[model samples]
Target: MTTPVEVRYFAAAAEAAGRGAEQVLLPAGTTVGGLLDLLAERHGPALRDVAARCALLVDGVLHRDRDAPVGAPTRVDVLPPFAGG
Candidate 1:
């Protein structure tokens, strides 16, 4: 069985997801986009859209592509765009 990964959401993404974070067990070799899809299904449409526009982080490092590979028991963070002057 695959290990459970901890996914953290911030700002609007967190509110939309209705939770600060979640722990999920993904099949081995699952792509980052696949994981987002799973989260969208679990959190609902609002979060799904937010996730689409957000940046992803793995273990505190930015994730550049949806196809990036993530192992089990990883720490994933979803960060939405922030506005500032």
Candidate 2:
């Protein structure tokens, strides 16, 4: 099995996902966009819609590049836009 990426969901994202976190296994050298795609596939349309409005933070750094690599044994936090923010 491939190394698991720690995925964390917050607020609306968490509610849509129906969970706070999960271990997602992806092959070596997967990117943020790839991860999002996989998450949308595994988590369903609710999550997919939530994901589009979410910001991704890898480890502690903001990642906007979907093609950017997601290192193994890492943490990816899913944060959606706040109501007023």
**Candidate 2 residue runs with Cα over 4 Å from true position:** none
lDDT of 2 by residue, 1-85 (tens): 4787789999988998899999988888788888888888988999999888777888888877778887774788988898895
Q: All candidates' lDDT scores?
A: 0.84, 0.85
Model 1 TM-score is: 0.88
Clashes per prediction? 0, 0
lDDT of 1 by residue, 1-85 (tens): 6868899999999999999988888888877788888889999999999888888887777875789876664788989888860
Q: Model 2, residue 5: displacement in angstroms? A: 1.9
- Candidate 2: which pairs clash? none
What residue pairs are clashing in model 1? Answer: none
User: Can you give the TM-score per candidate against the true fold?
Assistant: 0.88, 0.87
The global Cα lDDT (0 to 1) of model 1 is 0.84
Give candidate 1's error at residue 43 in angstroms: 0.7
